[model samples]
Target: MLKSNIKTLIVIVGPTAIGKTALAIDIAKHYKTEIVSADSRQFFKEMEIGTAKPNAVELAAAKHHFINSHSVTQLFSTGDFEVEALKVIENIFEKHDQAVMVGGSGLYVNAVVNGLDEMPEIDLKIRAALNKQFDDEGLEIIQNQLKQHDPEYYEKVDQNNPQRMIRGLEVFLSTRKKLSSMLSSTKKQRPFNIIKIGLNTDRAKLYQSINLRVDKMMENGLLEEVKSLINYRRDNALNTVGYSELFDYLDEQVPLDVAVASIKQNTRRFAKRQLTWFRRDEDIKWFEPGKPESVINMIDQELKKP
Candidate 1:
């Protein structure tokens, strides 16, 4: 049994389509606590089908925070999320001793678990120039530049994300320092105890799941949803895998079938990247997605520590 005075934050993390959401809900219901979403893609109100957000049934099962809480036009950085999520967790703690946080966005998850690093002040003009370059020369130009300047970060970052590529380039241009070098390894201490759980499976099975998910999204009108957001195609939020590929189809840059194939391919690559990021954190305990009882038992054991 958990102590009455102890407060714990159960962090659920894994690759996309790996059952993080279902497991998170189970844990939240078991602990009788609310959920704090760390998924950056699910924060936008306009993005629905493509983001694979929790359905009505899941949301009804447990109270959730930060889902559909921001607009695509809003500039909600990781630092902004860190501040807001901590407040949400604090609020949940007022009513219950535990809160659940879950997402596949490694950066956002890390922001809440370990505070963001202090970045050097970047010149507004530098960012403007980068954005102008992206508009005129295309993301390829900016991506190649970022790759040349900061190859370490280039390897890990989602190459499809223009905003991320631009940020890395702008930091190097403004400070003459690689963004990867500036990222400190220090983790900030949080007031509440944190138990991190990771879900994963064999690569072949995971890829099959991702492909099936993309097909399901198409069946659920992901193309129509992407069409509705075409006017905002340039927005950073729409530059993601599913939306971007469809945008390419609308632009006559690729066939619909080709676009769908790209989405699956990119999503599989994204899952690989998520694994790379989370594996670096030695605190996380891994489990197969099929075994929830083991995860709960492990969490119960960890809660008894110290």
Candidate 2:
């Protein structure tokens, strides 16, 4: 039985195209609560189709926060999200004893659940120099530097994401401290109880789902959507899987078929990275995507704990 006085945050995490949004909606409806999205990609208003945001029906099924909350032109960092999401959760707690948080972005989720460590203030000049180096020397140069300086973060970071690579580099250059080493080892306590549920399936099945989802995105006019955002192609938000591949296609770097195939391949690899990150969090209880009842029972079990 759920205690009336105990508030719970049900965190739904998993790889892309693994039915997290659907499960989260059902859970939110069951608890008579709202969902707070931690998916960084879905936060941008311009990134609808490619990000696989909740459809109109799903959004209507339950209230959601942070989906399409920011414009791609704005720089919404993890720290910003941490502050905003906490406020959103606190607001939800005022009305309901349980709230749902769902997303696949590991760092953003970690920021909310574990709290980000205080980062050393980076020098603007240092940041400018790094950006210039990226423009002149290219992503490979910065990626190599990060690998040499912070191998641990290098292994986990999205290597294709120059922004993340530059962040790791700038932190090291500014403070002489490795970015990975600066991550908080200690978990922060939240006022509400947290019930983390991870959704996953067998490897082959998950890969197949990712591939199919990419095909669905293509059919849903992802190419047209990417073309609409061509003006913002250089933006950090577009430096992601779906948009980047289509941008390459537009630049004549690859054929359309090849670009679509690359999206599938890259998405599969991304799912693997997501699983790796979530696996480290022993607090999360794993379940198949089809099993929401089991998840709810587990949430109930956790809520009843003293």
Candidate 3:
């Protein structure tokens, strides 16, 4: 069923540096619509270079929301994004027939489009305790405990994400309720029709593109970007792919070359995970990245189909 009589949202999503931004700008221009970003990392003003925020020309071209619009110190989450993005969309729909939501973060996109399950408010004490356990006992120990307690969530979650693991264990530890149980709740209906467009390519070619993007980022002064944000290293924004590996280098845990290679490897892994998450949605209309005309025509066809 159509969720709205007036509003439509075109969401452009894919892995990082797969040309999502360029395509989003083009679509936004085509529709004369504004764009809302679902990328969690790009929200921070201090994270310009590492996040690959749109350059000035692209930013001026598209009416973009949530790009470098928040401070790193502010606590934001998918829930916050859902609230803000919906409000933004409500306003945009006042002046246009469609709006665009674009980013690579799967959870953020799901929150905006499919809606997130309502979980309990986080208990700081429990979170602190879990973090201490992670620090003292190491991540593997926590991961193992989670696997034993909530195997379903362990399977669906990104195992490398310590924050998510900690939150899962926090809920299980506090209420003895499985995190997966909360996640299994029914989806909430939104007031706009949602159209999902997924970008993909041959696995080998995508991985090669990811590797090259990492190399270009390093050559373009990603190190300097991380260095500038050294004071904010403890911020959640720094807990991302490129910056995290650079942190390991700064800590002397590995050589610079190894860190760069690890960034490329981890980014490719992230892209793989993104594909895995997005592929689960049967509603997504997949397209190759280079075929803008085909994608635009496909969207037009879908929208026009009564």
Candidate 4:
């Protein structure tokens, strides 16, 4: 009844703190296959507690790759992940017909599953210049440039986010090609079939889970983790939500309580953005986080599709 003809990549995706890791492990174990992590934060070795990495029990549940595989010092871009993750998946299919990829990072997931556009990399000088212009002229100047250059992306991009706008401008400047036009608008066909399972909960409930998770992270010594990495605070890798907020506390710019509350609020915002990104993928099938059995059943059905 099953095709038995193609390998399958079972992608477990959801907002942060929504239990993707546990579900991915359970599913990987069921298939007796390995897991490839797409969570960008979890890739670095120095960041453990703040990133909410899998506990020893959860990790020993199944084999995983890309966890603690890089250092904050490394400039591991999404392009790097696409190449490495595909290799990992190829090795997985050598031993099993299925493998699980799990993460809250939408861009990294998209990079592996859909493939990034083959755009030329911009020089660091260009990026630094753009950043300086952004700081000096404010976003309106850069926004106007993007509007002039890549009006299509300008319309779709989040206008409030300078990073997105600057990236758009960077591509336009680097190649004179619209970042929108260079996107992998046509999804790349892979050798394997992909089955995407999205886990979501009531929005309010999701926010509450994030808040609680942050509290647990603090209890687990997120502040101490930031303290250890204080020297590397200038690194772009360390400029993330949890660590950055705690870094602010360390800098004496904000009190500890304020930093904790800010982490919860910023994490909720990040989760909302994650949901927005994953929701755009029409291929993903959604389920309540409580009903992982339903997800398993869906995967069973998909694996049998011809």
Candidate 5:
């Protein structure tokens, strides 16, 4: 039996561009519960286009929590998300027995469902110093240092991701502690039964969809969107796959075509990493993307069980 029986809430998770939002909306409407979005990028109000935030019609369909709800300037973390999501769930359960939580961000989802490892607050001075190092010494130099100090973290992390590499090194430099040590500390129990439903399809099909989506984003003035947020380019929220490439283009570091290509490639790689992360979690119930009725029926039976 599961540890807690305080009613089972549904969580629909998968890779980006995998259609989690629509399915989650359907389930929320059927169950008459609000949705607590776990997509880390969607939390910032200024990041709609790049984050692929839910549309007006979807928001009107159900009470969506945490989508475009916070400012980019605010400090947000998985631990903070866990606390806020639980509060939302508590309020939701008061009106309905269960609610739906959905998104592709594995860490945020895990933070809510299981819990997050305790992490120290990052000092702005440390972050600024690291940012300067990235600017002057370049990412390769920092990455090599991390590889030397904590090879385990370097292997698992996206070496191209400055935000992640900096955070890892920050923990190490501040406390003389390995990033893995801090990250693997412990897990706390939550007071709800989490029903995880994952969606996936053929790899080629998924990549094709991602490429097409990138093209659509460009058509929808994604470049213009990124241009407007140039001031906040250094913000963690803008460190995502789509915006980062265009930021490079705008900086004259890369050509327009090259940036667009990088977006497609990076998005594909991100999707693969998302699948790998979720696959490591054995409790997730997997399914192909196009089966809402079947998926809900399975959850309905589980929820109705005595």
Candidate 6:
């Protein structure tokens, strides 16, 4: 590749609780560039403590996009993210030769680095009806509906999350096709060069990090934040690990201690899933989170690749 034509998107990816935010800041500061967060959960303005969003200091350390950029009440999908992120990258590239994208959300990263297939627009009434059914009946009804409609997606989706179940059911209903099918069509090529860096550690260490992070989130008033968002619990953005567990406790479905334990355990599980998804991307060079300089050097080398 010619040096004059270099426009790189350095994608930092890894499991939750693996210190991705700090590493991304370091790299962006080194490159004198900005950051685009691909963590789907952090996109909502109403979510903070539960999404493990970057602290005030971190946000100030580097210019960031997509954090607190949307309302939890709004419908923001992966396809939407691809569109917005491309626009962000285009504007960023107009000034800098490189930009950093960091998050544990593999699909969101893929959407930006690759692209998204065309997803059919579901009728508003369909989602409205599904929401009503989920409210009146229960997640079980929606769960069964998804299983019956798109068994493939239902098998992989978080069955406890009504948002995922409803999404799968609505896609199937709207296009008469499986959401999984739509996602697996093909990867779209992007104009700029992409270099992916993955951070990970031993399982025990990763789990330890997850546990400690959950404990820290609890100490940081995660319970209170969840309680405050109780009215938005049914919103798609709140149907995630940390917030969902606390919401369960708020509803008397579990004790506080049990809910805390659930948050830690579910976070570990989520980290494991994130690693599995990222492992499939052979382009992502793995690195220890502590070795930022090495990771940066690797990016420098990859960008220099002929």
lDDT (tens digit, per residue) of candidate 3 on 66-165: 9988998998877899999999999999999899999988878988887888787767898898898877876788789899899867755556667767
What digit string (tens of lDDT, one per residue) describes model 1 on residues 159-237? 8999889999999999999988866468898888888999999999999999999999999999999999988998898
Poorest 10 consecutive residues of model 6 by lDDT?
A: 152-161
lDDT of 6: 0.86
lDDT of each: 0.91, 0.91, 0.84, 0.86, 0.84, 0.86
Ranking by TM-score: 1, 2, 3, 5, 6, 4
Winner of 1 and 6 under lDDT: 1
Q: Which ten residues in a row have the lowest lDDT in candidate 4?
A: 155-164
Give the TM-score of each candidate: 0.96, 0.96, 0.93, 0.88, 0.90, 0.90
Instruction: Write out the backbone clash pairs for model 1.
Output: none
lDDT of 4: 0.86
Higher-TM-score candidate of 2 and 6: 2
Q: Flag the better candidate by lDDT, 2 or 4.
A: 2
Residue lDDT tens for model 5, 1-306: 443457667989888898899899989988888999999889999887877888999999999999988988787877789889999999998888779999888778877877767677667788799889998987788788888888766655555667778878887877777876665356676677778899999999899989998998899889999999999887777777899899999999999999999999988898887887788777789888878998999887777666
Deviating ranges (above 4 Å) for candidate 6: 1-4, 120-129, 144-160, 173-176
Displacement of the residue 186 alpha carbon in candidate 3, Å: 1.3
| Candidate 2 local lDDT, 1-306, one digit each (tens) | 233566888999999999999999989988899999999899999999999999999999999999999999999999999999999999999999899999999999999999999889998899999999988987889999999999978766677787899999999999988998877677788887788899999999999999999999999999999999999987899899998899999999999999999999988898888998899888888999988888888877777777
Worst ten-residue run, lDDT, model 3? 152-161
Of the two candidates 1 and 5, the one with more favorable lDDT, higher being better, is 1
lDDT of 2: 0.91
